[model samples]
Target: MMEDTPSPIDRHITGLTGKARPRICYLATPSGDLPAHLDKFHAAYGDLGCETSHLAFFRQPDARSILVSDFRARLLEQDAIFVGGGNTKSALAVWREWGLDTVLKEAWGSGVLLAGMSAGAMCWFEAGLTDSFWGSAYRPLDCLGLLPGGCAVHYSSDSKRRETLHAAQQTRSIPSSIAIDDFAAVMYVGTSINTVVSWRTGSTAYQTYCKGGTVIETALSAKQISV
Candidate 1:
C-alpha cells in the first residue's frame, strides 16, 4: 500500500462498505496467489485495523484451504474484495473454473466493495486493456462487466498503455473507458463514478473515447490521498 497521510485509501474503501473497519478479502489469483503478495495485503490492511483474509487458487484446486464450505460463503463474509495485479488472463481462467466470476457478480450486487489496480481493477468491467496475453503488448479482453465499458491501469507508468487504449477507443474496439495512472483509482459506485482518487499527488485518471474518428483523452480531476 502506498502511504496515505489521512489514509483516504483505507477510509474510502471502508466507507464503500459502510463499515468503520471493513472485512477485506484479498484475492491474488491474478498473481498466481503468491504468498508474498498475500503477505503484503495482510500487512497493509491489517495495519489499518481491517479484518483481513485471502483466497488462493493456485495448485490447490479444491480451494478448501480457505477454510470455507464454498468460495461464495467465504466472500459473503467480506465487506470488500481486493484483487492483486498480475496476469489477468490466467486469473480469469481460474476464476471461471472455480465459478468465482458469477460469485463475484453476486458479491458486487450485495454491496461488497470491489477494488484492485491493474488486473484487479480491470476484472469488474466489460473489457480492459491488458498485457496479460502477450506479457508486453496491450490487448483488449472481455471481462466480467460488473462495471460499464472498459478500464486500463498504469497509465503513467506503462509506455504503451495510453496510446493503445486511445487507439482502441478510436477504433471502437472498446467502449468509452477509464484509464487510471499508477497510484490513482476511480471509485465506481454501482456503475457510476463516485470519485477519482490518488495515493500520489497529481496522479490522475482519464476518460478516453473516440470522437469523430479521433481519440480524445480527458483528464479527470483527482483528490490526493495517502495513509
Candidate 2:
C-alpha cells in the first residue's frame, strides 16, 4: 500500500542492511514492472537516504538482454532487494525462464537481504496460496523454496486467505506455513525466524497447519514497531 508517510517496516528493513546509506534494489516483476508501482517504490524509498533502483522484466531490452553473470554481479552489489506485490504465478514463470530464481538465491546466500510484500514475500517460500489463476479459486503455487514450507499473505485483510490456506493444508496440498497479516512481517535469518514485527497494532503472523483434520492457527509473538 502507498502511504504519504513511509511505514516503519521500511525503516526496519533499511536498518537490517546495517548501512547508513544502503544500496537497495526493487523488483517489480510480479506487477509486470508497472510504472506506478515503481514510482511508489521510489517515492517511499527515495527519502530514506539510500540509493534506489529497480530491475524490470517487462521493460524494453528487458532481462533477456542482460547476461546472467552481469545481472548476478549487479544484484550481489546491493545491500537489499525488495519485491513488489503482483501475480505470483506469472512472476515465477518469468523469473525461472530468465534464471532470476537462481540469482535471487545467490543474492540471499551472499548476505543481500531479501524482502517483499504479498507476492514478493510468498516467492521466497516453497509454496504460497495465490489467487493468480484468472478464473479459478485460490490455490497453492509452488515457489522458489529459498525458505522452507509455505506462506499466506494478507491473512487478516482478506477473509478467504485463512480459509484457502487451511483448506490447502487439510488436503495436504502445502506444508505447515506462516500466515502474515498486512502490516506485519516475519524476518528469517538462515532458515529460522529471527523476529516478527508489525506496524499496526493487532496485526501479526501465525504458524498455521493441519492436525486431525482440523486447521490450527498459532499466533506468533510480534513486537509492534512505531511508525
Candidate 3:
C-alpha cells in the first residue's frame, strides 16, 4: 500500500451530489483510441449527464489542450477523472516521460475521484499481468502499486486471460489478489471499494490471492443499474 499524504482540495465530480462522493466514468479505452469491443463508453456516460471527456493519447501538456495546462483546475471542474482502459504498456508509455503517473498519484492523494474499467483499473493495482501490450498470456510486470496486492482486470477463470493471469501469479509468485469480472465495476471511496452499477448486465467474480486463494462471484444491487 502507498503511504501518501492527505489530499488538499478534493475534486467535486460534476452531476450527482452527495457526501457519498461523485460519479466517475471509466471508459474502456483512451479517448480516440478505443478497442473495437468497448466503444460505447462515451455516449454511455454522456447520456447520463456527465460531461464526459477522454484524456488518453494526450499530446504534450498545454493549457490550450487536454494533456497539460493546469491539471488542478481541470480536475476541479469534474467530479472525477474518467480513466480509459487500453494497453497498459501503451498507456504507461504515453505518460512515462512526464512522470504523469506520479502526477496522477498526487491527484489521487488530493482526493480526486478516479474511476476506470479494465486497463484503467488494472494499471492502478500493485501487480497482476501488468502493462502488457502483447496480451500477457501468463507473465507479470512489476507495476505501480495503486491498490493492494495484485489485481486482475476483466477477471473470469473461465477465460484464457484469467487463466493466464492465474498462471502468471503462480509463475511469478505474486501476493494476494482481486480480480474484477467484465461488465462490472468496483467503485472506490478512499481505500474502500464496493460494486457500483455494472455494464455487462452480467456478474463480476472476485478472487482472493493470499493464503490459499479463492474466487468469489459477488453480486450487488444498486439504485442505478444503468443510466
Candidate 2 C-alpha lDDT tens digits along 9-68? 998898899999998888889999898888788777777887887788777534323333
lDDT of 3 at 134: 66
Q: lDDT of each structure?
A: 0.82, 0.88, 0.52
The model with the greatest TM-score is: 2
TM-score of each: 0.91, 0.94, 0.68
lDDT of 2 at 47: 78
Better of 1 and 2 by lDDT: 2
Error of 2 at 35 (Å): 0.4
21-114 per-residue lDDT for model 3 (tens digits): 3444333333335433223544454444555454434333222234344444555455566566556666666556646677667767877666
Maximum-lDDT candidate: 2
Question: lDDT at 215 for candidate 3?
Answer: 38
What does candidate 1 score on TM? 0.91
Q: Which stretches of candidate 1 lie over 4 Å from their true place?
A: 1-8, 59-65
RMSD of 2: 2.4
